[model samples]
Structure formats: structure tokens, C-alpha cells
Target: MSLINSLLLLFIAILISYLLVQLMQWSNLFDKWLDQISKKEDPSFGNDTEGLLEVVETLPQFTVSDISGQLIGIQELIDNKKTLLIFLNEECEFCGSNFEHFSQLINNYKGKKNIQVLFQSNQKETARNFYDVYDGKFSVHLYKKEVISEVGINFFPAYLIVDPTHSIDLITHNPIQVAHSLNFD
Candidate 1:
């Protein structure tokens, strides 16, 4: 009888262990499903290459100040010439590393294109310092933090090409590709 009792106890323990393992497996599967759903809901979670292909037809009306405290309207700038709007952040390492490349790109397209560097940050001085360090070659603007969210930008170093008709022609993260799309060298 004692042997039978011991066997029964062992069987129950094994059953419990199996059930616990199944439960864990189910939990893991559920977590994975949840993650997929989250990514699907958030467009920013996907690959940057895919995101860059989307063309933004219209831009939100915005008026931001340049480094010299002059107010500049987005529509007004696009009205004058084909504008290259480069959105950057002061604290972004990617922006810091690519500053010279961007400056060179601006210089390469100078007079041919109105290239503006838009820095959205509450710390105006930091943005100014970043512009000054880069020799202030491009037209730099300082905007409030909300401008980034308003533009639906998930990452820094985004480029948008606005034609004289005030329509956005190309929007991407790769500045070189954008320049190429516009037939810039």
C-alpha cells in the first residue's frame, strides 16, 4: 500500500510539472502575439527603409524661428524655391556624426535649392550651438518640441523636399538619396 501511495504521489507531481510547462509555453506565445499586434499598430516600429518610402502629401502649417530670431513660415519658404527640409536633433549622435556630410550637401546644392535645417528642441541654445559648430552653412531653424510630433517623425535626420508649388515631392531619412531624387550631385 505504501508503494502504491508513493507511485500516486510521483504521478501527481509529474502531471503538475507538465501542466506548468504547458502554461509557460502558452504565456510565451501570448506575449509574442501581443508584441506583433503592438508593432502593427505603431508604424514607427517597422523597418526604416519601409517607412522612408511613404510620401507625405501635405505638411502641417508651421512657423518657426531661425537662429537669428527671425520668424520663418514653412509655406513661405516653399513658395519661394524648392526647399530641402532636414529635421535634426541636437542630442542625436547620428545628427552629430553626419553634420559635415549634411553641410557639404547643403553647400553642393546652395542657390540651387533652399536647404533648411530644422531643429526641434526646447533648448534653443543647444540647437544654436550645434548650428554654430557646423559653421552655420545652412539655414537653421529652432522649433518647439511639438513640431516633431506634428510632422509624425519617428527618427531624426529626416529629409523632405518641398517644391515651389508647396507640395512635398520626397520625404526620406537618407539625405543623399533625397538629393539624388532631386537630381542633385
Candidate 2:
């Protein structure tokens, strides 16, 4: 009888623990806790800083076309100005969210900072779609994959700030990083 009572007690504890966990999950408390944990993690842990370092540390001169289908070189686009290069994917959910924040940033810094929106050369249709709806005064250009690869672009919604000397001063994975880099935060 004593052994049966001990087993019953253990079962109850386990059942209570299981239900508590389920309640937390059902209320999304577990997810919020996980999000807090993830937010505390080092940003670089998810970013391949090594990959960008291994690739071109400086912005390279590469040619891409503008909205009118006219070919333009990177040097010409930047034209000795410090530029913020934003590489966005039309299909990416994150990019769609970031676009609004970025548009506001670009509008605020219009002439003060040379901000350029880049799309993969292959994504002409997607680029055109973005261009059509985009009301920002910033120039939108298409970039070759090689150009971005040189800058160590491994993911969508990539960002880099190149100084007037063509040095890549900042490389980042998220919109917060962009805001921080631009000192808009």
C-alpha cells in the first residue's frame, strides 16, 4: 500500500507539471520567454562576420542597371559619397517589414546620406515591382550577385554602409543594426 501511494504521488506531480507547461504554451508565455532569451543572445552569433571579412572588406566597383534599364557602375552610383547599400528581397517577409522603416530613414537622410536600394540582377521583375510602389526619392538599382557576394551577402535583407573611400564600414543582418549604424536609433 505504501509503494502504491508513492507511485500515485509521483504520477500526480508529473501530471501537474505537464499541465502547467501546456498552460504556459497555450497562453504564449513560453514563446515570450524564448523570445526574451533569443534577444539577449549576441547579434554576431547568428551573423557570419567571418564570411564578410573573408570576402571583400571594401566596396567593389560593379555595374548594374537603374529602373530605366540603363547600365550604371557602382562608382558612378556612389560618386564619391558615403552610401548605405540595402539589399532587399521581394519575397522575404522580413524585407517587406523592414522596407517601411528603411523608407522613413532614407527620407529623413535623403541628401545627407547616399542611400541605394539594390536588387539581384536576376530579380528585375521583382525590382520593377518594388520601384513602382516605392515613393522614396532614393535611387533604386539592380546589382549582380557577384557584387553582393564580394560584400559577403549570405542572406536576404542584407545591409552595408560604405564610406566615401569605398571601405565597407558596416555589415549587418537586421533593420535594428541598420538604424544603429545610421545613428537613427
Candidate 3:
């Protein structure tokens, strides 16, 4: 992708993230409601990501090499399980700003056998060290510049949830909205 297109995608990502945050915080939307007299919870007072994540057209067939030079196919990774593909770069300013949220997200899904978390970074030299921040809680892959574009990624700090059906379920840049998007419930 050219610099202009990349900048455009980054702008769009930031805008979408901002709009979602505004929507989430729209008029105490996340506030809790309780029955004062009955001392019971409100039946219809629950929050969910009912419409935040739209259906992704799915990723193309592509195989990427990890830091250890292992070729992992996207289809194979999603077989009989879900794969959370994280695209990040060590030098990305936006990525650096969201490190805390990313850390929390990694921690949330760490050691989850039912699903697989794969981290993709372009920093070859910092591949293993970059993940050390997360205590190597998940697998990190190093891919060529074209590989990210081949996978339809234009920006850093993006997340994709791929299901066993060979489709990308969710793609978002906001870490706070990840849980809402990953509705395994």
C-alpha cells in the first residue's frame, strides 16, 4: 500500500475507533441498572456487541512464516478452532499507545486451548523480543511486507477473529471493543 492509502486506512481506523467509543459511552449506556426494592437484577439490563462487528468477507488463502521460519497456513490454523490474528509493529505509534490494552487482551486469551492467538509483526529483529512484553503468552510470526497486504491488512494494532468456517468474523483496531466483537457466547 502507498503512504497515502496507508494514512487513509489509519485515519479511518482512528475515526471508527473514536465513533465506537462515543457510541459505547452514549448517555451512560454502560451504566448498571438494578431493582432497588426487589434486590434483583434487571432482566433486560445486559450489554452485548449485537451489531458492532459486521460479517467480514473472509481472508484470502495465504501462508505466512513465523519467527522460527515455520510456514503456517491460515486455513490450517482455523481448523477445528478459532484463530485471533493480531497485526502489530514495534515502531507504530498507535500500536505503542495501545500497548496496555493489547497486553490486557493478550492476557485475557492466554493459554486458551480452544482458540489460537497468532501475532504477526514485520519487525524481524525484534520479533521474539517484541512478544517478550507479553511473556511469550502466544505465538508470534514474522512476515514479509507483502504478506500483510496479502492478508488484507493496511494498519497496525488490528485484530481478526477467524472461525473454523474459513471466515473472518471480526476485524477491529480498538482493543476495548475486542471482547465485544469476540462473542463466543
Candidate 4:
């Protein structure tokens, strides 16, 4: 091959390699980038540190059904008080466990009269069954599958702590992890 042709191929290869590297970095394929930038520990990524529990600028609201088939609006539920929202699915095993943990927390803070516990389930009957199985007397509302996407939920058993205006204060997948940081016990 001619030297000019060889050099041209070399240049093309280098450009492709640079493009690939840039794509990976942009897509979060480089873990070291997160390690260097993230506030959490590099090795352990421990939950001991309090996460960013910021007040959300805009709140997403949806209407779901209660066990009794009563329409429940998330914004309406909060009224003027903070809300502890538990998003659960009957198919999720961890959600069941979280339900029990939430029950205890609810009982502990019963007299506070400011925070409301809302369990969002895919099915009304399924949620009711869980409520009955755990002997959970707390009321829950059933959410549709589309509603889940509407609220930008991509994980199961998500726990959202919202302030008086229905603005999110904290959003976490691990309720226990968040509870520990917040001294739920």
C-alpha cells in the first residue's frame, strides 16, 4: 500500500477510537468518572451519608383508586401536610417487606398528624390483600401502570417523602436505607 494511503487509514482509525472513547464517557460507561465526581465513597458507596433530599420544584400528581375503589389524588392526599408515599407492586417481594417496616414507622409516628402514608399499588385488590395479609390498617391507593411511568418511576418499592406542598423531599429505592439515614426507628 502507498504511504499516503497507510497514513490515511491510521488517521481514520485514530478518529474512530477517539469517537468511541467520547461516546463511552458520555454514556457513563466510565465508572472512574462517577467515582471522581460523585460525593459518595468510591469503593463502598455507603448509604451512611445523607442523600440529596431536595425540595422538588415541580411535583407530579396522579389519581389512583383506594381499596374501596375511591379515587385518590396524590396532591389531594397531602393537603397541607407532608406525605410518605410508598410505591409498591404485588409482584415485588421487597415491597412486602417494606410494607411491614412502613407499618412500624407509621405506628411510631401516629400522633404526629402531619405525615400521611400512601401505598401505591398496581391493583386495588392486590394492595388490599397485602394490607390484610400484613394486618396493615393504613389506607392505600391503587395506581395504574401508566401512572407509574407518568410519575417517572423506574424502580419498584420506591419511597418518596414529600413536603406540605406535595413537593418531593426525598426519592429512594431502598426504603430501609433511607429510613436508617432519617432515623426512622
Candidate 5:
């Protein structure tokens, strides 16, 4: 009788332990799901997270058309110079506000480094007008609407620095920090 009671107690303890472990796992999964939902609701949620450049092993090659309808390859853009690639949306308010700052940065770096602005919009004329109005001093390109997805960018006003060796680095979302990262004023 004593031996049976001991075995029964041991069995109950093991079952309870298993239940607790499963409950903890389920709770953790629930918490993660909530976090994801909240992040999706917040536009700027993931902007502070580490960007793709930290994880990607290689930069993909791409070709885009400049404002003047010239076909420019990524390699040609970065040829023998450190290139600052600014991805913008003509419709985005934040992007619109930063146009002058970007133009100023490009002007400051003119003849020293390559600065290119890639507008991710379907309206080529709108992009051209924006560039013209701002007196943009950098090479301006109109990217295909799908280029954003192709490059894995989730936000506009994103910055990428391509070194002379063609290696790419992602600057943080802060414009001041991005300018500093490129050693620009």
C-alpha cells in the first residue's frame, strides 16, 4: 500500500510539471502575438530595429532609370566612390519635408561622393517635378513601384551607403545620424 501511494504521488507530480511547462509556452506565444499586433498598428515601430544590412550577406544587383531616362546600374552608381542612396516616396509627408535636407547634403558632398535619390513612385512626372523644385543636386532615379519590396525596405526616407567596394551599409532612420554616418554635415 505504501509503495503504491508513493508511485501515485510521483506520477501526479510529473503530470503537473508537464502541464505547467506547456502553460508557460502557450503564455509566451500569446505575448509574442500581442507584441506583433501592436507593432503593426504603430507605423514607426520597427524603424529603430536593426535593418537588413546587418543580416544580409550580399547586396543584390539592380538597374534603374534615371530622371533623364538613362539606364543606370548599381555598380555604375557606386563606381570608385562612396554612394549615399536615399529612398523616398513622393507622397510621404516625412519624405517631402526631408527633400531640402537631402538636397543640401548632396550639394555639400557634390564632386566628392556620389549621392543618388531613388523615388519609389509610379508618377514619374511628379518625381521629376519634386526634384526640379528642390533644385536637387544629386542623380535622381525613378524606381519601379516594386523596387521597395525587392530591396526589403518597409519604410521611406531610408538611407543606404554603398562603399567603393560595392558593400552596402544601412544608416539608422535619424537623418542627422545618417548624415553624420556618411561624414556629411
Candidate 6:
């Protein structure tokens, strides 16, 4: 084959390989890479990525005004109790399900002032409307879209569980699992 043709074929092969690598990563086939790292160790059965949806690398302490116009800080909320931080966008269907789950959790934790349901929203109007829907069940907060985007939460409805000491416990996509993990009672 000509040198130019050979070079072209090489470039196409490289491109295809790169795309396949990305696809594998996107599909979360990290097991193959993990296996290479450890041959003796068997993969953990609890290797589900769904649990990661509720996690925050470092639980940040910040003050945000609730829908009732009350200034609530993260530390203060979790000073002596757990907190459920829900990131919601009004248009997201997942968020609607999350809201219902939040209500169930609230019912479970009824009259327990320790558990605070905090909200972070992309749009103030949508946030306000969401607050209206919940109707004081949760301490909803509104934030700028860029703020949430900056936090690197690509998912629409992200849930984070913060312990009593204001430390992250788990991040999971399953709201039911989140409620169970937190032991909302």
C-alpha cells in the first residue's frame, strides 16, 4: 500500500479505538480496569453506581434562604441531626418522583425537627413553585443555575445524605435506598 494510504488507515484505526474507549467508560465498565489493578481481589457485589447519586465529595457549609425567607445554614441544619439535600429542576420528571419520595420521608420523620429537607434549584421561579407544591414540608432554597452547574452535578435530580456532624454518608440515585440508608424514622 502507498505510505499516504497506510497513514490514513492508521488514523482511522486510532479514532475507532478512542471512540470505543469512551463508549466503555460511558457504560461504566470500570470493572475491566479494576480487574487489571487487582487480580487477587474479587469485585465487590455492592458495586452499584446507583448509590453514587446521593454523594457529595466534600459537604460544603453555606447559608441559603428558605422559601419561607428564613436564613438556614448547612451546619446549623445538621448541627444535631441528618439532612437530606435534594437538587431539583422544575421541568425534570425525576424531580417530581423525588418530591414524592421527599414527602414520604418527611412523613416518616414527622415532627422530628432534626431532619431538614433542603432544596437547591436552577431557577428561582421554578424553585419557588416547587416550594409551593411541598407547602412548608421542606426547607426549600433557591440558587442560580450556574451555581449548581458549577458543582458538577450533571444529573437532574441528585440526592446527598449528610450526617449529623455535617459529613457526607452516601450519594445514591435510588430515592428509596436513600431513605432506607438514612433510616428516616
Best by lDDT: 2
TM-score for each model: 0.63, 0.66, 0.59, 0.59, 0.63, 0.58
lDDT of 3 by residue, 77-184 (tens): 667577677777775545655656766654665346333334444566566776676576567776556656666655556667777776777666566656545555
Alpha-carbon RMSD of each model: 12.8, 10.3, 14.6, 12.5, 16.4, 11.0
Model 6 clash pairs are: 51-171, 51-172, 52-171, 53-172, 54-171, 54-172, 55-171
- Model 2, position 154, has a per-residue lDDT of 65
lDDT of 5 by residue, 43-68 (tens): 34333434332333234678878887
Tens-place lDDT digits, model 1, residues 1-185: 99999999999999999999999987886586446434433334222344433445667788989877888788876666777888888765466655566556655554465778888747578778877876765677887787777766776667777777767666666545564555532
Pitting candidate 2 against candidate 5, the one with the higher TM-score is 2
* Model 2, span 86-152: residue lDDT tens: 8887655457666777666555543366778898888888887787777545578887778756766
Alpha-carbon shift of residue 14 in model 6 (angstroms): 48
Candidate 5 residue pairs in backbone clash: none
- Tell me model 2's lDDT, rounded to 2 decimals: 0.70
lDDT of every predicted structure (CA atoms): 0.68, 0.70, 0.59, 0.59, 0.66, 0.59
Better of 2 and 6 by lDDT: 2
For TM-score, the strongest prediction is 2
- Residue-wise C-alpha lDDT for candidate 4, range 1-185, written one tens digit per residue: 69999999999999999999988865673364344325432223243223333223446777877777788677777776666677777665456666677556555443444333345454666777766776655556777677665655555566666677766666665544445434321
Specify the poorest-scoring 10-residue window by lDDT in model 2. 45-54
RMSD in angstroms, candidate 4? 12.5
TM-score of 1: 0.63
- For candidate 2, the TM-score is 0.66
- After superposition, which runs of candidate 1 have C-alpha atoms over 4 Å from their true positions? 1-49, 52-55, 105-111
